[model samples]
Target: MDFLHSGLAAIQRHLAFVAVDPIDWKFYVQAFSWTVTLFESYLLLRQYPLYSKTSPPESLARHIGQEDFEKSQKYGKDKAQFALFSKLFSQCIDSAMLQYGFYAWCWKAAGSILGKFGYGGDYEILQSIVFSFTMYLLSSLPTLPLSVYSTFVLEERHGFNKVTPGLFISDLLKGWLIAFVLGAPFLAAFLYIFQWAGDRFVPWLMGFMISFQFIMVILYPTVIQPLFNKLTPLSDGELRSRVEGLAGKLHFPLKHLYEIDGSKRSSHSNAYFFGLPWSKHIVIFDTLMQQSKPEEVEAVLAHELGHWYYLHPTKMMAISQIHIFSILALFPAFLHAPPLLRSFDFPKAVAARPPTIVAFLLFQMILTPMEAFISIGMNAVSRHFEWEADRFACELQDRLKEESMTDMGDRLGRALITLHVKNLSTVWVDWLYSAYHHSHPTLTERLKALESFQAKRAKKE
Candidate 1:
């Protein structure tokens, strides 16, 4: 046993020496970053073949014709190819930035520039903010053309884009203005807290973030959304009456039903409710109203109500807080660790500590695997909530119908199918890919679950 233990220790020491002794830290950072990038890209591309191989289940086949099926497959292929190229380009840019010391150089340059203004010396936190802002501005400038091409060429090809160049430019300017208005105060507060609170900075930062998120949620429907799209109240009519009646029946308070001009930006459709309970408002996409029947629209709203019914949003918020606590607790240790800092070429001088924001960025790179795991876990929970919401919609539709147009399950199933077809969603996703990427089950899975529920209910009747 002693011999075996000695041999293992000797092997580990040799391996550590080989890993650390010969290569520059830059090479290790580049190698790890590229490896992760390539691996993720491969994971996404591999799913294309898996998706192509899987035949549609009988439940979905009934709703989608052979012609639509072929189109959907083609759609997936187009997206997969585009995604591969996008990932390659984005990762190459990121890798180049890391390899060429872009971030470190930015920190030095920003510090020097800020020093000219007499506000930079010894204020690592302010320097960090300046560095961060400069990096963000530089990185985003190159992507503007790519964004325009995707919106105009790629999305237009798919018949999804409704944005004109004028609207697009206006939207871009509005976005930047909003980002500055919202982000600057938060950045200042963040740096202030880090400087003022020494050991207690973690909890203070956590509290601030949670408060900011809650504020955003309350502001999203009323303040921010109006900047992007027009929101007009649903006119008094049968559809409005039905929606109001449905909301009343569910005991979910309705502040107002707003029809958003979603078609102004894209052909895709969506509906959502936002704000606190007292301020809850439903916003339905104009495209959805145009495409779906009044009853179908009501059905979609019912699903949204299901999320409220189960308190899924509150539950998710709680989960996020826990995650924040864990991250904040570990972050300081990562920031202070000599080896971690050394790996990133952080200054070795004892008096000159690395910027907190830079350390946080490094921490994120180290936590990539953990982040992926957390994403998978969160998506799994989200998928569960989605199923519950779907079932709630089905049951509510059944209860409300006096004379059934069709089985409530089948009605919702068809609605799902319609949305999927119209959106050109991938019909079948690989299991591993779905585990990481999907927050809701495929249309076929939900349909089957709903059908099974209806069958059991009928047997009881």
Candidate 2:
């Protein structure tokens, strides 16, 4: 811990010049952000051509019928077109916001609102909370129509949208309410740490963030998720029995098994498990049950369990903590830099003693290019984890010495194909586009890997 602080202090000293340098941070931010946006748009253009392909990849050809394959292609094309336009549209809105100093205006507006409530600038934490929500609400407003069109028109045409107009409105309101209910206290505590800890905020902030994630892991399933979707204990029968038996064999600490009403929003089919190390719950989407057989669903659970067994989630969390630490460690210099705030058109008085939230927000904007690259790295790591999980599922028969589980790989492959067909997920992905965007191996890639895994096991036998 002492060494960590020493390192952070060293970094702060090295970047101390940032406090006095008159860099045009705003121009750099704008240039880099637009560059990323355009590059992403280019990736979409690369991927857009693949959607015109007439059929699924040759490996997937046997699994997907011609009509279903055509549907997937059409769906992919439609989604890609929407994505291209939406990406450009959003960038334009954000670019305009930056060009006109919307962030500076937002901070002032937050102060105005805070003053109306009898709070002064001395209440920085309270003011920060107001500033956050004000920015979130106002910035999000411009993109809300895009979200609406995606859900109502685009998804509806794809025959996947299960959201009614009234339900959509209700969900939106509930989401905003939940955001306020949770976000205010979290933001207050976050800013308070900066005050309480002063320059030694990095380690403490990391601890708080990690604790919050743990809390969310508990609250999301039990409280927040239940608000959005129904989760009934999976009905007793072959599926439940199979899942329980698999869990027992793997010693997965199975606590509660649930079937979530995922079809209430969309026809997407999936399953996942989450909880602390000791107690875990598995939730399967009802749509998955409706689409695939009991055994196939069991196979899907097996693949998910593979993730748990390999500690993928924990590893991912650790990686995120490091990412956060990197961001926080470099923040103190920027936090004290008046020029950074001024570059974005903040008032000289406000910029001189910059608010923590304002500085952090600008710092993040300056990190746009870096974050874009970090996402590519994270995606690579996630895709590797997915491969390992698939392999783990393939070899489960050997791990448990269960004869009945011999065809787990085949079952998983079938489930993957069914899911892709049902969801109309893009198949024939451009390699470069996929490297940037995909967090999991494509369906054909996974199926081919599974085939090799089965073959390898057979050879060992």
Candidate 3:
């Protein structure tokens, strides 16, 4: 503890200028945020032209029918245009808000709302909660039109939207309700820890954040997900048998197998597993089952289980802890910086004693450039994990010593191709755009890698 305190103290001293310096933090934030936004827009520009191609690549031409390829190209072009427009639109709103003191106004508005209910500024946590939701609800309003257009217009045009207007509104309201229910207590606990631990909040806060993640892992499947979609146990059949057999062979603590009604809202398909280390549940989208063969689905699960075998999720969580700690460790210098808040147009009284929430929020804005770089690195690591999982699926026969699984790689490849075609996923991608945004390798990349894995395994055999 002493060593940690000393280490953190040294960091705080290095950043001590933040506390007393009269820096134009808001200007820096605007510059950094705009730089990220414009660079992303440029990447989209680089990628937009790919959608104009008249044919699929030679490798995928056999897999995708002419009609499907054209449809996917059209979908990709439409989405790219929407993305380019929405990115600029959202950035305009954000830039205007910052230029005109929206955040500072929100803090005061939250205090006023609380005052009406007999609460006062003395309740900083309550004010912070109110301020957070205020920002969330208001800031989200500007993008609601885009969301509706994407769901109803774009997706509906492409024959993927399964949502009615009524369902959409209901989902929106439920989302708000859930956010408040979960976020309020979480924010309160977060602020309380800072107040209690003072300068020593890093380790304590890291523990809390990790604990919250574990709780969410348990809650999301059992409670929160059911509210959005149904998750019935996969009916006893070949798919279930294969999945269970695979799990048992791997000695995975397979607790439950469910098929989700993902088609209830969208035609997108996926499957994943989650739970504690001792027990886990696998949920497959009904659309996935409808689209692929039993063997192909089994191969997909083999790849998913590979993620478990290699501890990808745990490694990602560890990286996230380091990210969070880095943020918290460098926070104290900003925590009391009156000028940081003042530059954002906060009133003198409010700026004099920076609220933890305000300080944290502003600090995050200051980290726009750093966060963008971190996102690229994280995506690279994620893509590497995906490659490993693909190889694992390919080599499953060797791992389990099962002759029946020798062709798992081909099955997985077919499954992935089917998924991409059904979802109208873009085939041609810009390398720079993909590095910045995509968490998985492109279909061609994965397919090529899968073939290599198969060849290597054949040589070993």
Return the top candidate by lDDT.
Answer: 3
- lDDT per residue, candidate 3, 324-384, as tens digits? 9999999999998999999999999999999999999999999999999999999999999
Residues 103-219 of candidate 2 have per-residue lDDT tens digits of: 999989988998998998898888888889989999998999999999999999989999999999999899999899999999999999999999999989999999999999999
Our tally of clashes for model 1 stands at 0
Candidate lDDT scores, in order, read 0.76, 0.93, 0.96
| Tens digit per residue, CA lDDT, model 1, 69-161 | 776777788777777887788878887777676777787788888989998457776777678778878878766777887899888888899
TM for candidate 2 is 0.99
Clashing pairs in 1: none
TM-score order, best first, reads 3, 2, 1
Q: What is the C-alpha RMSD of each candidate to the true structure, in Å?
A: 6.5, 0.8, 0.7
Q: Once superposed on the true structure, which residue ranges of model 3 sit more than 4 Å away at CA?
A: none
The list of candidate 1 runs beyond 4 A from truth reads 1-32, 50-56, 346-351, 397-407
TM-score of each prediction:
0.88, 0.99, 0.99
Q: After superposition, how far is residue 271 of candidate 3 from its true place, in Å?
A: 0.5
- Ranking the candidates on lDDT from highest down gives 3, 2, 1
